[model samples]
Target: MTSTFLGMPTTAPRGVGHLRGDQSFPAAARRALADSQLRRNLGHATATIRAKSAAVIAEAPDWQQLRDAGAAIKADVMARLPELLEQLEAAVTAAGGTVHWAADAVEANRIVTELVAATGSDRVIKVKSMATQEIGLNEALEAAGITPVETDLAELIVQLGDDRPSHILVPAIHRNRAEIREIFLREMPGVDPALTDDPVALAAAARRYLRQTFLHTPVAVSGANFAVAETGTLVVVESEGNGRMCLTLPETLITVMGVEKVVPTWRDLEVFLQLLPRASTGERMNPYTSMWTGVSPGDGPQQVHLVLLDNGRSAVLADEVGRQALHCIRCSACLNVCPVYERTGGHAYGSVYPGPIGAVLSPQLTGVEENASLPYASSLCGACYDACPVKINIPELLVHLRAAHVTAQRRPTTESIAMAAAAYTMDHPALYAAAQRAARLTRLAGRRGRGLPPPLSGWTIGRDLPQPPPQTFREWWAER
Candidate 1:
């Protein structure tokens, strides 16, 4: 159980998960912005997704109504999360599946590792799961002497290259086909030596490599898109059929999902299925939508285990304004439309989650002090709010988190001190007029196109300040 006082989470200490970054957002973004190739990759990919999403979303006559319904459903679920979770546990248990509760990432990782060990397997095949990634499960498994193989093509590319995922839907979005070809040749053990940068050739090579592992791996791990409380059903929506294969082929399966993923009824699930695919892949519906309850007589994995993860979610739910971030369906729509994200790329945000949602969510989950710069990463453009199928109002959330960060600071910053001086000057007419007259002296400095000095230089580096007018409006009026 996590508690919040004065808008701060007191539950878990930081540094356990992937939410905090090694460097502040500005420092990381500077490096990413300098990489012209990375910008080209992101620009081309995001543009395509945005165009496709707009076309498909336009086809739905009831899109706004659906968004309303989805928002309402999420609001209800958040309000009654504890009760719904208990109901979900009971239903899953009744259907012969085991349920486990994990307070944080460490506990969840230990539970999944022990389950894999009990199966007596040294290797496991995996479905692409953000929840598992959030917990750094693959790294944890390797530390325990077990190997985890990623089955998704994008995830496989990331794994082979030993690179971090830059986009939520497309982990390797930062890499183009040529880079992927190079990675396959260098790292994929059985890859064809003649593999080309052609998409078809690259995909076939990966499929051939993963075929045997899919057939023989005794254990599989996944993350659910939604869990139905009424029927104890778990759902996974994916563009590729790999998730379906992992769900069925393995003898034992373990699923780790965020506690916020549970919806009270099947009716609520209906809204998201229609919303997720269109917003994410720009498809009318996912190519593969896998749903299962507990276990079937011999149909799927015999042993099913569901680990409901908290990992600061309870703390997020404690804050009224910040909790809406949990409504994210992992759709990259916000990313596609975010100017800051499209330009700087996801690696700059320094979290498993990125974009406008990440700017707000990561700070709240890890506490504002740990991820302080994230809140200021956005330009407050409202495109993300418009693109969100669940209507998260991401721009508003960014502002809210920024205020939280400023409030959390123990000392007054230079910006705060400057603001205070400006406020004081504005309150008195004589001081304000004197300050205006003193400002005209800057034109002398501006003759050579010089920028403000020291504290104000950072703002002027990317922009040009106009020369002050020869006379103020007040001065002109007085002369008349």
Candidate 2:
């Protein structure tokens, strides 16, 4: 099921989104865990979201059936992605809209920048869009001397603070009220000086700041929750009305969406609309759900452009076991219940996509070697699988990606050598007995409940190694 772009294999695309540094997840997690404030913020936010999701999900008696349907629909979309995307492009064009295919993040950004430049506007308002973030579109726009304004409240907070989003549904979940207030005061040009940390006040201040941009911005960019292949309709679901304003107020509207976001038909939207709100914001229905079929006369944006972004998605779909990661609907339920994500937060994952989904998705999309450590970021508790509305087996994918990482290594690592040695020793009964005897002798030299020497010492830093028993299990068996 290898996906191809322009006749080239897409398993590993160049210049797709990835972490900036060589630092691995363990290093990042260590630093993040040390931040008490971050831990508190993540803990509180995830706890609240988890509780709300649980409550609403309980109200839906057929939630599992809905989940199954969502998974099936996504699977169908992935299976026929190439065909559906063609259908979608034709539909959008027939409806007087243009569609562009971007094989990677670099191409997507270039297309978007060029499109904005064509409009002769140096600024564009943006609805909260993970696709844009994944491509670093705001930075790209700024590099080209264009300003990109974020209109969503949480996205606005993250943008103003010059921080990366730590959660999917709530981008600024890492920032508390007081932190948000400080960012608003320091960064916002015309914010009230006497602003407080009250949620309503924060909302009002953000609204006041974004109102002018929403009213006057000539262009808007967005990401789709789902794109219906049958009607060429792009859907954006949000709690705030900002997405609506962005979709309608602008004369030229551009949407950047992952190719995986497409569904086969309008009927498929029903399952996702029901699944998304509950799994994400814990609401029965989103406060606003906007859908537009290409260009509309005198109603919304006259010029509609859609950039169907691959950016390693086709590569992700290439994997049989890991392809299920594409079924994700950007619901952050996996984050809410994930023990590792709650403790270390999203920055540790070092991608736009975070939490348990990120753990599997990032590595597979970018090549497991690039994000090798991400596969090991989870505790394999399977909470993510349980929480996912689309039932992506995130834990299984994590392990599969890890094996991919190991298989791709050109040289044998220390862990690999150790594993190989242990395998050989266990294969021979005499050698196994000798190894056990040797381990017991080493136990006599080392103190009980003490850290082991180098390599092994790293594992025992936080806990002591247990002393080996005097008699080997083989010796006990012989006595019996």
RMSD to native for every prediction? 2.4, 2.8
Highest-TM-score candidate: 1
TM-scores vs. true structure, each candidate? 0.95, 0.94
The candidate scoring highest on lDDT is 1
The Cα local distance difference test for each model comes to: 0.90, 0.89
Give RMSD (Å) of candidate 1 vs. truth. 2.4
- Give the per-residue lDDT digits (tens) of candidate 2, residues 251-304: 999999999999999999889999999999999998999999988899999999
Instruction: Flag regions of model 1 displaced more than 4 Å.
Output: 1-12, 443-450, 461-470
Residue 165 of model 2, lDDT score: 90
lDDT of 1 by residue, 1-480 (tens): 545454444443455668878999988999999999999999999999999999999999999999999988898889999899999999999998999998789999999999999999999999998888888999889999999999999999999999999888999999999999999999999888988999999989988999999999999999999999999999999877889889999999999999999999987888999999999999999899999999998899999999999888888899898899988889989999999999999999998888988898888777778888998898887999999999998888888888887888889987788889999999998999888888898787555568888787766654587788889777998999
